[model samples]
Every structure is written in structure tokens, then in C-alpha cells.
Target: MTAPRRPGPAPALDLAALVADPQTRIIVCCGSGGVGKTTTSAALALAAAEAGRQVVVLTIDPARRLAQSLGLVELDNEPRVVETPGSPGELSAMMLDMKRTFDDVVSAHSTPERAEVIFANPFYQALSSSFAGTQEYMAMEKLGQLRASERWDLIIVDTPPSRSALDFLDAPNRMSRFLDGTMIRLLTAPARAGGRAGVRIVGAGFAIFTRIISKILGGQLLNDISAFVSALDTMFGGFRERATATYELLRQPGTSFVVVAAPEPDALREASYFVDRLSTEGMPLAGLVINRTHPPATTALSATRAEAAAEAVAEAGGKGAKLAAGALRVHAERMTLATREQRLADRFTSAHPEVKVRTVPAAAGDVHDLEGLRTMGEALLAAEDDTGTGTPRSRVLPLRPQAG
Candidate 1:
């Protein structure tokens, strides 16, 4: 019988080597919410730029903390230059605008008149702005646009958080299905047909479909949808073609996918899902980044030992007894947190031993400027060697526990 494989420590990811490669054109940072994906993306871009490669980091709904850290005062669809002191390479950053990107696609694919017609349609506006999958689809569109521009050597994409991180992979097919669905084809049948005979042939089916949809969506909404679909029918081929091209680009050799997460149970679980999903889809996996990990305050004292010391100090009841007791309690707390984080990380490493992981120790404060990000980039490499052989560094990491 085959032996059950035992888990081992994952190989360390070398961030410097990843960005130094000339052929590495795209790096995608993706994970569940609040795991520092945006900050990681910015830090990676800045580090790469500082190392002398022109880079652009595209973020989707970045948190204010992350935006401020990257010096993004007013984020929009357009990329704005970020001043990198002492760096020969340039760095630019932008946040995705789903509606504008959709409009741009429409304007590009169709004639001016047709584009206006499609844009004016209420259904088109609604879909572009608030549809469930529109943001992911537009992200793919924007990525394609950025690549086509050839303005930068490296493109770092910070994917939307939560399950939507996977949506980009499925968005093209979802869009294709929507366009080729029964309702859309039924609505566009007359448009596809030529002259009066074609209209007569399609009129009955179109009327039935419209009536059925009109009951669920109001009459005006159904009419708006039918009109929009008809107007967009000619451009559907182009949308699908571009989406497919973007999907292929993601799977290309020069592209790499980094799964970011904290050393917590739920976040690590999400990371595992990302790893499996990327592998199943045959995407190029560039290893994992375990951010804001905690190492014990002092290796000389264990959590139990700290607790015992605290108890002894409290019982002794001297002038400084309370202060000493409080300090011991704090040390115990730090040891407990570190042990919890280590166990969680080990669980993940055990499950996916082949996947490389780079751990960054928790920072003392929130990263809010260029210097902070540079420090963080350095931490990605430095923390690996600081295994607490001597003095302790920080108490606990600032990472929030992600919900599964």
C-alpha cells in the first residue's frame, strides 16, 4: 500500500528573483479580503521599480490605508506616477473603474452612433455599473488594454477581494454565456435577420420572450434590455474575442500568480482554495506570501513559563510587583499569539508542501508611506532569517482574522 505523505516546510519564495527576471511581465496578487493584498501589490511594484524595472500597479477598490501608503491621494481609472526616490525605474498606480472601462470597450468596438445608442440604454448603464460580474470582466478588459499599450515592463494587478478574486477567471465564460443565452439571442434575432421577411420569422418568438421577461422586469426595463441587446449584438464577437485573449494572456509563460494571506485558519483556507483553483486552471503559480506573521517576543520564555512568572510576581506583592506581573502577562499573550499563528501556518504548509511561501514578520505600525513600503519589501526577505535566535522583535502582527 502507498504511504500517507507527511507534510514539510514549503520552500521560501525569492521576491528579488521574481522581479529581476526581464521576462516576468505580469504579477497578480489575489486573496480574500483584509489580508494586505493591495499593500503587497504596491510594495512589490515599488520594489521592482526601485530595482530598475518600469512597473504599474492596478488596484481594485483599495482600502484608504493601502492607498495612502502608496501616495495615492486621488485614485481613478487613469494611472498616476508615484515618486520613487533613488529608483531609476518608474512606478505608476491606478484603481479600476468598472463603468468607465465598459464604456471604453463599447466606444472602441462600435461606431460612434452605435456606441452612443448602447451607452444611453438604461440596461447597458445598469449592467456596466452594478452587475455582479461586471467588475471582474472590466478588470480583464483593463488588463488587456494595459498590456496592449506596452507602456510598462511589469504590471502588478491587485485583484478584488473575497470569492470575486476567482471571478476574473470565470468572467469571460460568464459573459459569453450571457451573450449567447436564449433571451439575448431571442432579443437580437430580428437584428441578425435582414429586412421584412427576417422580422416576420423572428417576431413571434421575440414577442413571447419579451412578454415573459417583462413580467419579471417591468415593461420598460424589458424593452430597454431588448433594444440594448439588439444594438450590442454586432459587438458581442469582439467582446468575447478580447476576453478570450486576456484569459490566454493570464495563462502565458511571462505571467505569474501570487496568493497572499495571513497566518490564520480562515485566510490559509482561502489560500489553499486559490492554490487548488490556480493549479486546476493551469495558471503559473509564483508561490505564496504569508504577510504580517508573528514570532514570539522571547524564545527564552514560553507561554507557560511567562504565566508562571506572572503568578509568582503577583503573589510576592512588592512595590514593583504589579508592574512586573503586567509585563509577564503581556509576554504570555504574545507567546500565545505567536504559537497560534505558527500552528495555522504549519497547517497550510503541510497541506501544500510543494508551494513556496515567504513569511513577513508583523510591522510595528501601519505602513503609510513610501519608506514604510520599502521597509515592508525588505521585511519579505529579512524576516526569513530572523527566526528569533537572539532578541525578540515585535509583539504581535496587525493582521485581522479573515472570515471563511
Candidate 2:
């Protein structure tokens, strides 16, 4: 009988190559919330710039940490240069402003008078600011604008940290549906056909629909919605066409996706789903980054050994014995934590053996500066010898599942 093949470490993702390659014009970092997606995106852009590639990193998340890390007070729709030492190339970063981007799209596609009308509409104001899928749609629109400008050699996108990693991917389709849906067509019918004649073409159901909408939204709000839809009807086709083009852009050769996750069950599960979804949609997936991984200690002492040693020191009760016991106890706790983290990572690898992965060790504290981002970039490439002597004493180990 043939034996089952044992699971092994996944192929290492060459982060340096991914960032340094000139052909890679776009890199998207996507994952669940709190998985360090923003930091990873910044680090990659910083690394690419230092490697002599002009890079612009865009964050869809509204978090302020990205701005603070880059030593900037704030970030807006326009890119801001990050002044980091030893950066041979250039790096710029920006945060998406959904409303502003929508207005920009309107200004670009419509005549000055029409754009003014659209902008002044109350419904347009609400849709631009808080409508469902607005953020994702605006992110896509901004990306399209950046690509068309060809100002940067590479663009790194930090997708929104929503619960579903697919939110960004599904944005274009969702927006298109909302624009072309039955309700929108009905609302705009009267405006398109000129006066009440358009309402007669829409039949009896239109009357009932408008009546119900009027009851909920009042006459003024319904008129605002109708006027908004009528003015936007001409631009709807352009909106969908651009969205489709951007969706195709994501599937192009120059684009690559990096799935970021923490060394935990929930994060890894989400990463797995992202990997599968990318594959199903024929999107080019580069690999995964297991961030905040705990590296094992180099000392000969194991968790069991450290615990035993601590107990012995406590029992002996000699001078400095209490200090030694406390130190040993701390060591024991760290060792246990490192072991548990490794096991979780190991499980992820076992499930997705074909996917390449790079592990980034957990830092002592939060990354809050350009220098810290540079260090993170090095860790992502596995080229940092943080332990001194130009080499690390130990590497992060694979995590195993815990017993119930």
C-alpha cells in the first residue's frame, strides 16, 4: 500500500523579488480587520522605493496609523511624499476619500453645468458619502485614475479591513447592479421620457412604487431622488464601463495580490477563503504573509525544562533565588506562547500546501515610524538578522493544533 505524503513547509515567498520587479505595477494587500494589512502595504511600498522603484501606496482603511507611521499629520485623496532616509527612489501615500472621489468622477465625465447639478442634488450627496459599497467603488475609481496617470512605477493598495475579504473584489459588480437595477430605472423613467409621459410608459406598477417611496421619503426627498437619477442616467454607462475596465485591470499580468493574516485560526481561515476566491476568479495571487509570528527562543531551555527549573529555584530559596524563579517563569510563558503560535501556522500550511508563504516575526511594540516600516520590510523578506551577529539564532516554527 502507498503511504500518505507528509506535509512540509510551504515554498517561501520572495518578497524582495515581488516588490523589486519592474513588471509588477500593482500589489494589493487584503485580509480581515486588525491583521496589519495597512502596515504590510506601507512596508512593501517603502521597500520598493528603497530598491529604486517609484511607488505609491494607497490605504482604503480610514485608520490614522498609516498617516502617523509615515510622519504625516494627515493623508487625503492626493498622494503625499514620505521623506525617509536612504530611499533612493520615491514613495507617496494616500487615504481614499469616497465622497471626493465620486465628485471627481462626476467632474471628469460630465459638463461643468451638469456636474454642478449632480453635485448640488441632495440624493447625490447622500450616495457619495454613505451609500453601500461607496468606499470600495471609490477605491477602484482612484486606482483606475492612478493607473491611467502612469505617475508611479508601482501602486500598492491596502484594501478595506472589512470582515469579508471579498468586499473590495465585489465592489464593482455591486455598484453596477445598483446603477442598473429596476428601482433606479423606475425612478428615472419620468425624467428620461420628459414629464408624466415617461410615467405612462412605466405602467401602473410605477404609480404604486412612487406612491410607496413618497410615503417613506416624502415628496421633497422623492423629487430629489428622481432628479438625481435623471441627471446621473447619462453617466451610469460610463460608471459601469470604467468599473468593468478596472476589474479587468486587476486580472492583468502586472497585478499581483498578497493575502495577509495573523498566526491564528480565524485569520488563517479567512486567508484560506481569500486564496480560494482569488483562484476561482482567476486573479493573480502572489502568496501569503503570516505576520506577527512568534520566533522560538535559541536557548537550550524548553518550556517544560524552564517550568521545572523555576519550581526548583523557588523551592531552594537561596539569595537571588526569587529573581531567578521569576525570570524562569517569564521564559516558560514566552516559550509556551511561541509553541502555540507555531502550531497554528503549521495547520495553515498543511491545509494550503501549494501556496507560498513568508512569515514576519512579532515586533516588541507597534510600528510607528518610517524606520520601523523599513525593519518590517526586511522581516517580510526574511533578510533581517534581528538577533545580532548578522544572523538570527532561531527562526519561527510551525504551530500545531491544541488539544481540547
Tens digits of lDDT, candidate 2, 1-404: 66655456577778788898999999999998888989999989888999999999999888888998888999999999999778789999999999999999999889999999999999999999998788878888999999999999899998877655456677778877888788897887656665576467675777888898899989899989888888888988888888889989999999999999988889888998899899988999999898897665544578899999999999999999999999998888877887776677667778888788887878789999998998898888654244532223122553233433
Question: Positional deviation of 328 in candidate 2, in angstroms?
Answer: 3.8
Model 2: ten consecutive residues of lowest lDDT: 386-395
- Please give the lDDT score for candidate 1: 0.83
Q: Residue 350 in candidate 2 has what lDDT? A: 83
Q: All candidates' TM-scores?
A: 0.89, 0.89
lDDT (Cα, tens digit) per residue for candidate 1, span 16-116 = 88887989999999999878888888889999998899999998754555569887787789999999888999999988999999999998889999999
Show model 2 residue runs off by greater than 4 Å. 1-6, 191-208, 312-327, 383-395, 398-404
